[model samples]
Target: MSLHFDHNRPIYIQLMEHFYRKICRNELKAGDKLPSVRETAVEAGVNPNTVSRTYMEMEREAVVVSKRGQGTFVTEDQSVIQQLKETTAEQQMDVFLTTMKQIGFSEKEILDLIQKRLSALENGGDSNA
Candidate 1:
Protein backbone atom coordinates (compact mmCIF):
# COMPACT_ATOMS: atom_id res chain seq x y z
CA MET A 1 0.00 0.00 0.00
CA SER A 2 1.34 3.41 -0.96
CA LEU A 3 0.31 6.59 0.85
CA HIS A 4 1.00 10.18 -0.11
CA PHE A 5 0.84 12.85 2.53
CA ASP A 6 -0.18 16.43 1.98
CA HIS A 7 1.14 19.05 4.35
CA ASN A 8 -2.12 20.95 4.73
CA ARG A 9 -4.24 18.17 6.25
CA PRO A 10 -3.98 15.91 9.26
CA ILE A 11 -2.01 12.75 8.52
CA TYR A 12 -4.67 10.49 10.00
CA ILE A 13 -7.38 11.91 7.78
CA GLN A 14 -5.13 11.45 4.76
CA LEU A 15 -4.41 7.90 5.86
CA MET A 16 -8.13 7.21 6.14
CA GLU A 17 -8.63 8.54 2.63
CA HIS A 18 -5.81 6.37 1.36
CA PHE A 19 -7.38 3.29 2.93
CA TYR A 20 -10.74 4.19 1.46
CA ARG A 21 -9.24 4.44 -2.00
CA LYS A 22 -7.43 1.13 -1.61
CA ILE A 23 -10.60 -0.62 -0.46
CA CYS A 24 -12.64 0.96 -3.25
CA ARG A 25 -10.11 -0.14 -5.84
CA ASN A 26 -9.92 -3.70 -4.46
CA GLU A 27 -6.24 -3.25 -3.66
CA LEU A 28 -7.13 -4.18 -0.11
CA LYS A 29 -9.87 -6.77 0.09
CA ALA A 30 -12.30 -7.38 2.90
CA GLY A 31 -10.65 -9.44 5.66
CA ASP A 32 -7.20 -8.64 4.37
CA LYS A 33 -4.87 -8.02 7.25
CA LEU A 34 -3.27 -4.60 7.30
CA PRO A 35 0.35 -4.00 8.02
CA SER A 36 1.41 -3.54 11.62
CA VAL A 37 1.22 0.01 12.90
CA ARG A 38 4.97 0.29 13.18
CA GLU A 39 5.42 -1.14 9.70
CA THR A 40 2.96 1.27 8.16
CA ALA A 41 4.45 4.21 10.01
CA VAL A 42 7.89 3.30 8.75
CA GLU A 43 6.59 2.87 5.22
CA ALA A 44 4.66 6.12 5.25
CA GLY A 45 7.37 8.01 7.11
CA VAL A 46 4.93 9.18 9.74
CA ASN A 47 4.85 8.78 13.51
CA PRO A 48 3.73 5.37 14.74
CA ASN A 49 1.28 7.08 17.07
CA THR A 50 -0.44 8.69 14.05
CA VAL A 51 -0.79 5.36 12.34
CA SER A 52 -2.23 3.84 15.52
CA ARG A 53 -4.70 6.67 15.79
CA THR A 54 -5.79 6.12 12.22
CA TYR A 55 -6.31 2.42 12.88
CA MET A 56 -8.23 3.21 16.03
CA GLU A 57 -10.47 5.58 14.14
CA MET A 58 -11.06 2.97 11.48
CA GLU A 59 -12.02 0.47 14.17
CA ARG A 60 -14.44 2.95 15.70
CA GLU A 61 -16.05 3.39 12.28
CA ALA A 62 -16.44 -0.37 11.82
CA VAL A 63 -14.14 -0.22 8.83
CA VAL A 64 -11.81 -2.79 10.29
CA VAL A 65 -12.04 -5.68 12.76
CA SER A 66 -9.22 -6.44 15.13
CA LYS A 67 -8.48 -9.91 16.40
CA ARG A 68 -6.74 -10.30 19.75
CA GLY A 69 -3.17 -11.54 19.36
CA GLN A 70 -3.69 -11.42 15.60
CA GLY A 71 -4.03 -8.29 13.50
CA THR A 72 -6.51 -5.85 12.01
CA PHE A 73 -8.51 -6.93 8.98
CA VAL A 74 -10.79 -5.05 6.69
CA THR A 75 -14.47 -5.39 7.52
CA GLU A 76 -16.44 -7.83 5.43
CA ASP A 77 -19.40 -5.63 4.65
CA GLN A 78 -20.10 -4.78 1.00
CA SER A 79 -22.77 -2.29 2.05
CA VAL A 80 -20.31 -0.44 4.23
CA ILE A 81 -17.81 -0.32 1.40
CA GLN A 82 -20.42 1.04 -0.97
CA GLN A 83 -21.39 3.64 1.60
CA LEU A 84 -17.77 4.65 1.93
CA LYS A 85 -17.52 5.14 -1.81
CA GLU A 86 -20.66 7.27 -1.88
CA THR A 87 -19.56 9.31 1.11
CA THR A 88 -16.16 10.00 -0.48
CA ALA A 89 -17.74 11.04 -3.73
CA GLU A 90 -20.16 13.34 -1.94
CA GLN A 91 -17.35 14.95 0.03
CA GLN A 92 -15.33 15.51 -3.15
CA MET A 93 -18.33 17.07 -4.88
CA ASP A 94 -18.92 19.35 -1.94
CA VAL A 95 -15.32 20.52 -2.03
CA PHE A 96 -15.45 21.10 -5.76
CA LEU A 97 -18.65 23.14 -5.53
CA THR A 98 -17.37 25.21 -2.64
CA THR A 99 -14.11 25.95 -4.40
CA MET A 100 -15.90 26.95 -7.56
CA LYS A 101 -18.14 29.30 -5.60
CA GLN A 102 -15.13 30.80 -3.89
CA ILE A 103 -13.54 31.44 -7.28
CA GLY A 104 -16.63 33.41 -8.41
CA PHE A 105 -17.94 30.70 -10.68
CA SER A 106 -21.69 30.90 -11.27
CA GLU A 107 -23.73 27.70 -11.04
CA LYS A 108 -24.29 27.74 -14.78
CA GLU A 109 -20.59 28.12 -15.50
CA ILE A 110 -19.72 25.29 -13.13
CA LEU A 111 -22.32 23.04 -14.74
CA ASP A 112 -20.99 23.88 -18.18
CA LEU A 113 -17.44 23.07 -17.10
CA ILE A 114 -18.63 19.78 -15.67
CA GLN A 115 -20.37 18.90 -18.92
CA LYS A 116 -17.26 19.73 -20.92
CA ARG A 117 -14.98 17.65 -18.74
CA LEU A 118 -17.40 14.72 -18.55
CA SER A 119 -17.80 14.70 -22.31
CA ALA A 120 -14.07 14.80 -22.83
CA LEU A 121 -13.47 12.00 -20.33
CA GLU A 122 -16.25 9.89 -21.80
CA ASN A 123 -14.70 10.33 -25.23
CA GLY A 124 -11.36 9.02 -24.03
CA GLY A 125 -9.95 12.44 -23.25
CA ASP A 126 -10.51 13.69 -26.78
CA SER A 127 -12.42 16.90 -27.26
CA ASN A 128 -16.03 16.17 -28.07
CA ALA A 129 -16.90 19.59 -29.43
Candidate 2:
Protein backbone atom coordinates (compact mmCIF):
# COMPACT_ATOMS: atom_id res chain seq x y z
CA MET A 1 0.00 0.00 0.00
CA SER A 2 3.00 2.29 0.33
CA LEU A 3 3.27 3.88 -3.10
CA HIS A 4 5.21 6.85 -4.41
CA PHE A 5 3.18 7.79 -7.42
CA ASP A 6 4.64 9.58 -10.41
CA HIS A 7 2.27 12.18 -11.83
CA ASN A 8 3.32 11.20 -15.36
CA ARG A 9 1.67 7.81 -15.68
CA PRO A 10 -1.94 6.87 -15.10
CA ILE A 11 -2.67 6.11 -11.44
CA TYR A 12 -4.17 2.76 -12.38
CA ILE A 13 -0.90 1.78 -14.12
CA GLN A 14 0.98 2.76 -10.99
CA LEU A 15 -1.33 0.66 -8.89
CA MET A 16 -0.83 -2.31 -11.19
CA GLU A 17 2.95 -1.88 -10.96
CA HIS A 18 2.70 -1.89 -7.18
CA PHE A 19 0.76 -5.12 -7.20
CA TYR A 20 3.13 -6.60 -9.76
CA ARG A 21 6.13 -5.87 -7.56
CA LYS A 22 4.43 -7.23 -4.47
CA ILE A 23 3.53 -10.45 -6.22
CA CYS A 24 6.98 -10.92 -7.78
CA ARG A 25 8.69 -10.22 -4.46
CA ASN A 26 6.47 -12.76 -2.73
CA GLU A 27 5.05 -10.08 -0.47
CA LEU A 28 1.72 -11.11 -1.91
CA LYS A 29 1.96 -14.88 -2.19
CA ALA A 30 -0.10 -17.18 -4.30
CA GLY A 31 -3.71 -17.29 -3.15
CA ASP A 32 -3.20 -14.28 -0.89
CA LYS A 33 -6.24 -12.05 -0.86
CA LEU A 34 -5.83 -8.62 -2.35
CA PRO A 35 -6.86 -5.57 -0.42
CA SER A 36 -10.45 -4.71 -1.20
CA VAL A 37 -10.84 -2.08 -3.89
CA ARG A 38 -12.16 0.43 -1.36
CA GLU A 39 -9.31 -0.35 1.02
CA THR A 40 -6.72 0.02 -1.74
CA ALA A 41 -8.32 3.28 -2.85
CA VAL A 42 -8.11 4.62 0.67
CA GLU A 43 -4.53 3.48 1.10
CA ALA A 44 -3.50 4.73 -2.34
CA GLY A 45 -5.35 8.04 -1.93
CA VAL A 46 -7.04 7.40 -5.28
CA ASN A 47 -10.61 6.97 -6.42
CA PRO A 48 -12.26 3.59 -5.90
CA ASN A 49 -12.72 3.24 -9.64
CA THR A 50 -8.98 3.46 -10.12
CA VAL A 51 -8.40 0.51 -7.82
CA SER A 52 -11.16 -1.40 -9.56
CA ARG A 53 -9.57 -0.69 -12.92
CA THR A 54 -6.19 -1.98 -11.79
CA TYR A 55 -7.70 -5.10 -10.25
CA MET A 56 -9.71 -5.76 -13.36
CA GLU A 57 -6.62 -5.42 -15.51
CA MET A 58 -4.68 -7.79 -13.30
CA GLU A 59 -7.49 -10.29 -13.53
CA ARG A 60 -7.49 -10.04 -17.29
CA GLU A 61 -3.75 -10.64 -17.30
CA ALA A 62 -4.22 -13.73 -15.10
CA VAL A 63 -2.11 -12.29 -12.36
CA VAL A 64 -5.04 -12.48 -9.97
CA VAL A 65 -8.33 -14.29 -9.88
CA SER A 66 -11.51 -12.82 -8.47
CA LYS A 67 -13.99 -15.15 -6.87
CA ARG A 68 -17.53 -14.13 -6.12
CA GLY A 69 -17.89 -13.27 -2.42
CA GLN A 70 -14.35 -14.55 -1.71
CA GLY A 71 -12.36 -11.54 -2.87
CA THR A 72 -9.52 -11.40 -5.40
CA PHE A 73 -6.47 -13.58 -4.80
CA VAL A 74 -3.05 -13.87 -6.34
CA THR A 75 -2.77 -16.53 -8.98
CA GLU A 76 -1.65 -19.97 -7.84
CA ASP A 77 0.03 -20.59 -11.18
CA GLN A 78 3.76 -20.09 -10.85
CA SER A 79 4.10 -19.77 -14.63
CA VAL A 80 1.96 -16.67 -14.60
CA ILE A 81 4.27 -15.06 -12.08
CA GLN A 82 7.29 -16.13 -14.12
CA GLN A 83 5.78 -14.64 -17.24
CA LEU A 84 5.16 -11.43 -15.36
CA LYS A 85 8.78 -11.39 -14.22
CA GLU A 86 9.94 -11.70 -17.82
CA THR A 87 7.57 -8.96 -18.91
CA THR A 88 8.87 -6.65 -16.20
CA ALA A 89 12.44 -7.33 -17.24
CA GLU A 90 11.65 -6.53 -20.87
CA GLN A 91 9.89 -3.28 -19.94
CA GLN A 92 12.80 -2.21 -17.75
CA MET A 93 15.35 -3.00 -20.46
CA ASP A 94 13.33 -1.05 -23.00
CA VAL A 95 13.26 1.97 -20.72
CA PHE A 96 16.99 1.76 -20.06
CA LEU A 97 17.77 1.43 -23.75
CA THR A 98 15.57 4.38 -24.66
CA THR A 99 17.12 6.57 -21.99
CA MET A 100 20.66 5.64 -22.94
CA LYS A 101 19.97 6.33 -26.60
CA GLN A 102 18.32 9.65 -25.85
CA ILE A 103 21.36 10.61 -23.81
CA GLY A 104 23.61 9.90 -26.84
CA PHE A 105 24.99 6.56 -25.75
CA SER A 106 25.29 3.79 -28.33
CA GLU A 107 24.16 0.22 -27.68
CA LYS A 108 27.71 -0.96 -27.13
CA GLU A 109 28.41 1.84 -24.64
CA ILE A 110 25.24 1.08 -22.73
CA LEU A 111 26.05 -2.61 -22.54
CA ASP A 112 29.57 -1.90 -21.30
CA LEU A 113 28.24 0.49 -18.67
CA ILE A 114 25.67 -2.03 -17.54
CA GLN A 115 28.36 -4.70 -17.22
CA LYS A 116 30.52 -2.44 -15.11
CA ARG A 117 27.63 -1.49 -12.90
CA LEU A 118 26.65 -5.12 -12.43
CA SER A 119 30.20 -6.07 -11.57
CA ALA A 120 30.40 -3.25 -9.07
CA LEU A 121 27.12 -4.30 -7.51
CA GLU A 122 28.23 -7.94 -7.23
CA ASN A 123 31.47 -6.88 -5.51
CA GLY A 124 29.57 -4.61 -3.12
CA GLY A 125 31.11 -1.54 -4.67
CA ASP A 126 29.38 1.59 -5.92
CA SER A 127 29.44 1.90 -9.67
CA ASN A 128 29.22 5.69 -9.39
CA ALA A 129 32.03 5.89 -6.85
Candidate that scores best on lDDT: 2
**How much lDDT does each candidate structure score?**
0.89, 0.92
lDDT of 2 by residue, 1-129 (tens): 556789899999999999999988899999899989999988989999999999999999999999999999999999999999899989989998999999999989998998988998889886555
Model 1 TM-score is 0.84
C-alpha positional error of residue 96 in candidate 1 after TM-score superposition, expressed in Å = 0.3
Clashing pairs in 1: none
| lDDT score for residue 66 of model 2 | 100
Q: What TM-score should be assigned to candidate 2? A: 0.88
Which tens-of-lDDT digit does each residue in 1-129 have in candidate 1? 456778899999899888878988889998899999999898888899999999999999888888998988999998888888788889989999999999999999999999989988897877554
- Poorest 10 consecutive residues of model 1 by lDDT? 120-129
Query: Which residue pairs in candidate 2 have backbone atoms (N, alpha carbon, C) closer than 3 angstroms, thus clashing?
Result: none
Kindly report which residue stretches of model 2 are placed more than 4 angstroms away from their true locations once superposed: 127-129
